[model samples]
Target: MPNRRIFNSFFLGGFECSSHRRPDGRRLDLLSATGHDRMTDADYRQLSAHGMAAVRDGLRWHLIESAPGHYDWSSFLPMLRSAEALGTQVVWDLCHYGWPDHLDIWSKDFPDHFGRFAAAVARLVRDETGPQAFYCPVNEISYWAWAGAEVGRINPCAVGRAGELKRQLVRSAIAAIEAIRAEDPTARFITAEPLINVVSGSPEPQHIFDAEQYRLSQFEAVDLLTGRIEPGLGGRSDYLDVVGINFYPDNQWYLGGSTIPLGHHAYRPLSEMLEEVQARYGRPILIAETGAEGSARPAWLHYIGAEVRDARARGISVEGICLYPVLDYPGWENERLCQVGLLGEAEGWEKRSVCVRTASELRRQQALFEDVAAPEPATAAE
Candidate 1:
């Protein structure tokens, strides 16, 4: 039987925040309101008691490097200390779709500057939390590139700059990973890229080709990190240890008249996608971020857990599943953080204990993998 450890997974809560000043000259606090005061310690312990193995916390570049060569780790240190004390590991995300405004994104110095900041953070985290803690150098590189450079939705928004921004970000990511590894060779790194599945419209060959191209663009970071880039672009293999897939129900799409038979509420099955990534990358994979809409979370969790079990039965090294945005926060897409968390606002902290049918399904799926037969090798032809 395949080992049962492969199916064990849990949620990691928390979000991004820069330790810089807000427009009104107020220092921004990333912790939720209920977590805002001296009570954050109690909140951290509460999260641990509710089965969170780790918390995906953000350490913004602007915050760390407020001025050239100047840093203030005072604010972030406490959170890390609390997490460690609670026995919850941290997946420290270095950059989350933004950077210090002082640095020009298109300048040659950007990558080198980012690398220095990353190395500093790695040293501090290792010194404080030890070697086993995980690090995500960049969060959603593809999405940030596409959104800021291609779609023009964020700062320095520019349309049709996807290619340029993607290259820059990939280089930055590699540099950061290399810097972190330099500090601690055993440092675990996971690059959390959005797993977007684009289906073609009309079932026409051209549409299919276009959709494939789109999908390839999203997978480019993984390709570059794994040293499988096309001949023209340079590739870096040393950084690609784990592929972190972040998928939401809304992350998939059908273009040009193609219909996803799966309802808007339905999510793409995890087993098939997990197999594809494993077949292509040949490395352990983690569902770095995945969660259902609050109202349907019970059903969503059940379906995802089953999919994970199925992937394991097929011999994929599926590591863990994280329920993202475990606590409600502000400033999400359309300002709807409550929609994604396992707990609804009305339930408050009680949402943590609110187990739905999905919990039972997850338990059942875990049981199935406990004694399953070894899966056949995934052949290229398959």
Candidate 2:
């Protein structure tokens, strides 16, 4: 088994830091909505108690770069400091489906401005926190492409432009990687994208072919980044670093049909999926996002934990599993409370309630993976 000391812990917490504009033009700031922005210190402290010393968080690009060529780290500095103080390792997402309104996504200026912004962020983070850092330059490129261009549900709402938007995002990510490397060559990256399985609802040959094609589309962004396709975008094998897969219960579905229920004949085991990804990329894999709402939370985590163990036993370098949206927040489309986090919604940190069931499950998982995580090397500071 590959017992690499990648993350600080085998499990990770993830704050919902989505900063995207709705199709109707209303901007959503999940960090603020969940009170994480105000309770950064408290949030990190709580995660530490839950054994999540590492976390996935975001930098609100729209807030930081409200104007072109200008960055106001005022929106992000506190969060960075809080993590440093708490000794929390963060995979900072530079762009989580949001960008400055002054820039056009389709224009060449988008990547140009993003590269500069990423370089600036790298310098600041290195100055404050030290040499080692992790970044997800452009989060969920595949999903963002579909949401923004194919479905017209988010920014740059353009129908049938997913291909164009996807390429643009790839270019932007490559540029950001290049610029950040110039600042801190030791920086790591997480290319997070949704992992899905699509099965044909019909036995017809054409239907099966279409379903398979749609399912394979999930790899488009990673392939572009690896220079497997579209080499003109300046992607190289090294550009694709850690493979971050965001899996949800609803990820697998039948083409043109409803979500495929678990245990159904066509339902694929996550371990097998992990194996396929390992075979393809041959890089470290992180379950960068996975969780369920309310009553389903414990069982969902248990399922993923078991699958990850299975993958690891098979020699797949499964690095860690992140419980995304570690705190509950309001829904995107509607403001309904989504009970998907281990920590429940609260007006203040004192009022927050930890989901006992989920927390217990997490502890149980930690115990299971404790032997899998290698001991950390002692730091001079320690």
Candidate 3:
């Protein structure tokens, strides 16, 4: 069992800070679109009002690095100051599927430039916060590779290049970790990847094999980072530090079929999945992202919270559950309102309406988990 606590709160609010460009060539700045950039102080205060003291946020690399080797912290400083002032611990995402337009994703310079940018950001964070910092170096490398390189749905929209893109992302993540550690040796890292299950309804052997292979592919990026398969990428066991799994309702489906409904026999319990992750990595785990839309929010939280308790009771070192996009945001492709947050969309400093049901459930879970002893603070130096 792990003896150290990884976050200030077991329940965390995650800001959707994706800045990826759409396939139509329009860049999406979710922070501004959802008014989070203008309401950082209110956001932190709101999280505190709901019994949360930790958050998962991102640094917009595209906004920060306007020119090669140059950075402007104008866009990120205010949020950092707000979190620090309000005593909210934050896990920062250095690259969240967006980068400066000048850089080519396939170029050898990509990782090197990313390393430099990460080091600069680390230095800023170390100076603003302290020795202890948590960072998800690159968000969802597998998903990014698939969406951007494989399916041509987003920027760097190249078909049939996901393998190349995945390797590049792994390299970039290793570089970021190395650079950040150089700036702040005590900084802890989290690798957030989608937790998925692919089942095959067909009796054909090839179909079954394909489904299993697809399911296992979810671990590719983490494996590459841990040097489990690609030692030449400068990966090491420590680079895989804290395992962050992002789960959602649509995460599981049959090979050529629809989603496996929550209670179906084919639906795997989240506790079972967490056990697999912990057993494989022998490291702390975090539900780095999890949430549902509309009326599903409260029940989803209840279900996830319960499973987390089950995992903990079995001695799995599950650290925390983050309500990703804790505030609703505009959809990535359609620009439709995604009502998936505990708080709804708002303008400027206007107070956002709360999802009363989800907030109440969150409070209830907080009380239930209260009996569990809080562990000592965790650090990379541990």
Question: How many residue-pair clashes does candidate 2 contain?
Answer: 0
- Candidate ranking under lDDT, highest first, comes to 3, 2, 1
> What is the number of backbone collisions in each predicted candidate, taken in the order shown?
2, 0, 0
lDDT of 3 at 92: 94
CA lDDT scores, all candidates in order: 0.65, 0.90, 0.90
- Put down candidate 2 lDDT per residue, 229-271, tens digits, no spaces: 8888888999877899999999999999999988889899999
lDDT of 3 by residue, 1-382 (tens): 4445778887889999899998889999988998888898998898888888899998899989888888999999999999999999999999998999889889998999999999999999999988878999999999999999999998788899999999999999999999999999999988899999999999999999999999999999999989999798777888888899999999999998999999999999999999999888998888999999999999999999999999998999888889998999889988899999999956447478899999999999989876542546675733
Please give the ranking of all candidate structures by TM-score, highest first, separated by commas.
3, 2, 1
lDDT of 1 by residue, 31-134 (tens): 43324223345555655555555567776566557688788886568777877777666777887765776788899888888999988888888898776457
Candidate 2 off by > 4 Å:
374-382
TM-score for predicted model 2 compared with the true structure: 0.97
Q: What is the clash tally of candidate 3? A: 0
Each candidate structure's TM-score, on Cα atoms with residue i matched to residue i, is: 0.83, 0.97, 0.97
